[model samples]
Target chain A: MSDKSTLFKFDNISVTVEGKQVVNSVSLNIKRGEVHAIMGPNGSGKSSLSNALMGHPAYNITNGQAALDGVDILGMAADERSRAGLFLAFQYPLAIPGVTVANFMRTALQAHRGKDADMADFRKLFKKKMADLSIDPTFATRYLNDGFSGGEKKRIEILQLSVLDPKMAILDETDSGLDIDALKEVSKGINEYRNNNNAVLMVTHYQRLLNYVKPDFVHVMMDGRLVTSGGPELALKLEDQGYEWVEKEFGQKAEA
Target chain B: MNIVTDSKYMIPHQSPALERGPAWLREKRRASQTEFNELPLPRRGLHLWRYTDPSGFMAIPDSADETAPSENYKLVEKLELDHLKSGNLEALVTDFGGRDIKVSRSGDDVTKGLVISSLSEAANSHAELIEKHLYSLIGGSSGKFEAMNSALWNDGIFIYVPDNVEVKKPLHLLREAGVEGSIQYPRLLVVVGKNASLTIVDEYGGGSSDFRNGQSYSNAVVEIIAEQDSRLRYISLQRQASGMQSYLTHRAQAQAGASILTIPLVFGAAISKQNFGVLLDGKGADSKMYGLLFGTSRQHLDNHTLHHHRAGMTTSDIDFKVVLRDKAMSAYTGLIRIEEDAKTCEAYQENRNLLLSDSTRAQTVPELEILNEDVSCSHGATAGPIDPMQIFQLQSRGIHEADAVRMIVSGYVQSSLKLVPEDLRERISEFVAHRLEDI
Candidate 1:
């Protein structure tokens, strides 16, 4: 590999939840700059794959390999994995009762850049990111996710994505609970972050968000396995033909 | 398994030092000494002592007199902010174990016929006024600690606001205690005159602006006389050293059309138990009591309040919240008593406690005795640990677990601390934040 080359790979990884396997042998690879969309129905293991990769306690990775640039991250804690350039925008972020969003953001960034993180710089950067994302400045003072609208939560998630920039980002179901307007705003934030050295893997139930942030590749996952892989045309095809054709033709074979 | 008989128990000796006050006060002290000697140490049989046994307090430390004033003579101003109008009636007394009693009052109210004097000097200057109200309401037949205070208390503070005169600025009392093995019986007697209003902020701690660091035993008696048609707010803050032990009694009698609000913040002391009671003595008298307690370390704190609605159409509302961490423990028992003739009264009581550690614990019991069916009364109590989900959410954002817990505790307590008047909120918040740091 060249010095400039960057890669995040999940080579034949399996995840189990409560002794029942959820994500079965899956292999995927993304270099420094690429976008991949995992489109699947409910209970297709798409969410499990992202959670297992991020070290969520509920999802246990039972087999095979998962790594960042050939360095195994399967053994790393969630925070360690994050510090090593892995980021997951949770589908349902917990509501922290007393912590303000500004403080939470500062502390998270500090964990990576040392505790004495430049406060003035953080304020300046935060001001610009919040403005760019069209978030009200007052929202920074609110407790994290406490009484926030579904749309507001997704917006904050994108705001976090922009500020806590990582080498590769896994956005799990970022479009699931958002309205059309919120989905557009979320896609706008994701669209602004694409580069050759930064990858994005989006797990979604529909292709609504795909229309805004175009993906380089689209993979169909069914019953814990990636049944078929193809280009952006596959997303358009599934959007139009409704995933039934893919389930009938390839889901069973992939399961076997 | 050794218990001292009444004949062998320690009491104030009849030395000249103890006989320096008014002859009546001196005689009262001599009599109360016998009473303290005759009474046994508080056992677990009393409902108020269920959470603790005072018999463990084996020996009352002989008063260790301060040989010299701390070179630092500057007033420890915890509430003297530029924003506070309270500096108008300022009083500073440190080295409390010393033999000096002088209240350095700003005296704007004194010029308006207000009287704030040293209780020791009351024997000469305002002997009649002090004799009329001092020790008349709270501790005559109270208990061992009350009798001890009545018998041994050497210094006194007397605050008397003249009739129909409203001293808009607060009267500040800085009660800082130091000197190891010293037993201090500090007394504060407040008599707000008819139709007059006054505010008193009483601060208790180790004289310097530091948290618990000294070892002392203090028994304090606070008697407040809310004269007819008067309004008063008594805010007491305890920031004593962890080595200090305090057993206190606070009683307020509200006369007709009078109102009183008592706010007590309990933060310090190794073992502290307060018996706070209020009497609505006349028609239309009102009492609003709110308290906050934050205990950490191995501290044991017990607080009990009694709301005696003695007259018709009188009202009382009591609310208290406590936050505990480490091995700290707190127990609160509150009661609302509406006598048969006290009809058409309203009463509400609630106690909420947040326990932050596995070993930290709290017990709250809210009780009511209503003799009139026309009275409206309600009471509730709850204790619980910090929400783990709240902790996980903060950790997921990369904050350390300890910081997260501190934030939650602060939020829980800050909401109740907000009930304090605006002028005192900043200082109260600073004190709370500083205490949270130790946890």
Candidate 2:
């Protein structure tokens, strides 16, 4: 509950979907002004953890507590959670036809801010953010995520993150579908938003993203549990030795 | 006194004042009355009435005087009618009293010899032209409503465009309904000379909504003749008051190298049936018919269209869209018939419906009868609900379920509105939005 250190605390959290436990009891703390990366193999519940944090209806919180700045977010609706400064960059962005990206973004911003922003000021700020992310101006008029390439869609997610400026952002595999060039651009955008007042949870299966964003803490999740937590060296170790070494070490520890 | 009643005698006779009309015209109206009396009322057995019931309209009184215009009404406003040019004719506004009908010209290009005026006025001013064209295009035995319209119509519009003149702006006509039980018989006769061009937008909106048992009947007839190398764009927008019954009949004939475009938007009326017929009488003529209707509550809208290609090398395309919400119902039947000698013709027809609720119903039938070889023709119909995945996508972004549905419906209808002019697009969008609010 102390604001002097941790920005978000997930205590003894367990989530279930369709009677199958996906994210088991796990406790983690993300400190203010730091980047934390959760790296693991596929089906390690990384995405489930992110979705549960964002209050997605599909990911049921069986027995756990997720709080933002000491306020319980377990009972908040998705929009309410969003208004409370929670953001999620989905692994697959949905396509909404007939709704321009610019219009949708502005409406989201207004809804989150709880007031109508001046049109002139909003446009200027939006244009600046888009330029910083290297997004083309013509994208504003295009339909939301409609007919966008994989790389373009990823960049658009980053674009929204920059524009919304949420208190805490959960990027779910933003680097999964991106090429090298797109990954570099996305990393730059994410790094630019890293400040002393906000925190970020990057969920990925590889160490490529941590190489650029420079995570302050690296946690390895296996079978719905955070087996090891350490400094940046942990990410490099996992990338070099793969998940087999972690699985063996855990097996040995269990036997002992 | 037995107090006996007969449907035939229930209708009032056209005053002897029209006795001055040419003998040929008088005989035509009399013969039309006979046809109106003999033709059977549309029944549920008919394919055209599959999704709608006509029993409610059968009880309407045949007496036109019972719903005659009252003297208390005044011309609300005079719409700008100057957009019509010579050779290209537009619509006419007739007051309920059968006394005044205003006709305006939109453009200044008058070519050859053209005449545009009120029907009653034309009967007195240009009797020769009226005698030659009026009722000639509208067959006396077409249907019962056509016959009734011919016998009861008091004042209407008459347009004659000379050869080779093109009118730019669309001519607009406004028909105002006065008190309850107000019967309006609007007759329009348009004649396009050889090599002429014109565009007409006939709009009917303005009347009190408190007329529950008004038994209003709008028997309208439109006759168009397109000469060689001529083009005509005719648009009819009918938004009648609730609980009103409307029977409209429109017919057009296109000559060689002529093109005709007709678009109709029907929004109101308790039970309404519109019959539109386009005849390609000349080779190489083209016709396009487009329609959109929105029915809510217990309203019933029946639309029947016929595209007759009587000449060789003619083409026609028809597209109709309907949206039904609540307990409302809509029926659309389109027919494309090609004559034996109409070789190398092309025809296409499509009808699509969107049902917004479980109670709403829509019936669509697209028929094609081709008797000529080396011709291409196709017809299709579709009816269903909105896509659910699209809805979830919008909901995931924080938009409410209801607003998401509205956006989808708006987008579905916008496909047709894209063909309309830019100035009219926003107006139509607002109108559609307002209609959805009631749903």
Candidate 3:
């Protein structure tokens, strides 16, 4: 287990879905001021891990514990987890019709501040943030994620990240369906949130994202377990050799 | 036959047609009074009144005192009648008893060949047209209130658009109900001649804010006869006091190649029932009926609609939406009937209700009766509260509890409002916003 003072720590966390274990005995640590990438194949429990840490009701944490800044998060509700400075950029954002982005953003900003955000200042800040991402001003008047294109939806998720400014963000497959240009824009948005004092956990199946947003640590996940943890070199190695080499090594470890 | 013996006031005695109307119309009202006296009141077992109680009808006071006009009632805007002919249509704004009913007209170009006047004045002038179309659509009978309206309606609007002419701007009529235990029987007879087009708006609102002792009943009947190739757009705005009860019966018949669209918005009333019927009597005719209702704080809104397709190759579409909150209840029963000989007819009915609170209630019954094998018809109904996942997503973004709900509800009702005309869309949106304020 990582030290309690660490920004985020997952100690032997196990989660179950429909009476079956999907994420088993996984331990991970996200230190303050560092970007860690978790790369895994499909159905390897990547999303389950993120959802469990965020306390999604469907992903029950059967055992172990997750904490933010030494405060336990296992029993907290999803909203409480968010209030505690944890955020998840979903792979597929839900559409909320009739809810304009401006109104939704303001309400969220107020919730994070535990008070109402002054309309004047909030407007100014929102425009600035929107400008930073090169988003059209009229987009703010549209319903949240309703009838939005795939890339546009991704941009909206990042837009929230820019406004809410949570301490640690889990980007769950944020690069799944983006082309090179959209990938570059999304990476730029994520990089804006990157600083020396805040951490980001980027969960993806490809190393293309790592190229744009460099990470200090890269971990390989297979069959719900972390098989390897290395520097940025690990991502390059996996790209060169494919996941077959890691699968073979896991088999040997189990035999031993 | 003295029909007034059962009630405090005699029906034929209070009818304006009995005194001032032509002898033929006077005799018609007398016969209608006899028929109303003979017909039994609707009982609880009738399917038409399943969700409605008969007590509201039986509790009518012996006589509605005539109210003198007061300055409290205001006309936001006056519609013009210059383009209409001198003696074809009548416009009357009636108060309870004392004050004279005000009538104002705007716009220029009054040289056209259409009659425009008050119903009371029309009774003396165009008595023949009034006698022909008045009470003709009711046929045998409807129910108690409808029969009563046919027997004793005093003030109303009579519009007749001549053939081959198109009215540019929509005609607006405002009826304001005031005082408690008062009964206002408002009637409208719209006649569109062959190849003519017209749009009319009927706006109803209460003059008083008090609901309890200020209880009032408005039994309004709107009958439209669209000749071949004619087009008519009719919109009704029903805004009553909170504790008042309102009953409305609207019927329209579309002839060959003619079209009719009716949009209704119901916002207020302790208990309200609206019966809408659209009959396609000519081949290739079409009808579109759209309605929206917002009920909150113990309001009960019941809407019944029927699309009777008696002509082949005719089409009809009906979409009704309701939003209920704070223990408000809503019931919707819609039917699309295709007659045996009405082959190749097409009909669609859809009803959707959004319940904002657990205490709120909604019941939807959409049915279709088709006897023609070559016809195409379908109906759908859905009732559910807000989606939890949707709420969670909005909450994750930091939206407040109330705003999130507003967003969900506004989205649910926006689709129905889109079918209304541009001039009335903003008014409907504002009305919905006011209904959602307390919740």
Query: Each candidate's root-mean-square deviation in Å?
Result: 5.5, 5.9, 5.8
TM-score of predicted structure 2, chain A: 0.94
| Model 2: colliding residue pairs | B82-B105, B82-B106, B83-B106, B84-B106, B87-B161, B87-B162
User: Rank by TM-score, descending?
Assistant: 3, 1, 2
- Give the worst 10-residue stretch by lDDT in candidate 1 chain B: B1-10
Better candidate number, 2 or 3, judged by TM-score: 3
Q: By TM-score, who's the top model here?
A: 3
Tens digit of per-residue lDDT, candidate 1, span B1-439:
1112232357758544457587888878877777777887776876688997676444444435443223332335433533233554434433254234556555343447778777887668988988899878865367887887777777878888889988876766766565445556778899999999988887776522222434566678899999999999988888776676777789999999999989988988888888788899999999988899989889899999999999999999988989888899999999899999999999999998888778988988777889989999989888898776566545444555676677777666655666565656676777767867856
TM-score of each: 0.78, 0.77, 0.82
Q: Residue by residue across A1-256, what tens digits does model 3's lDDT show?
A: 4322368888898889988788778888888878899997788788888877876667788889888878887776676677788888888888877668887788778777777445568999999999988889998998888898888899889999988888789999999888888899899999998866668999999999999999989988887777789999999988888888888877223342
Per-candidate chain B TM: 0.88, 0.86, 0.88
**Cα RMSD, model 3:** 5.8
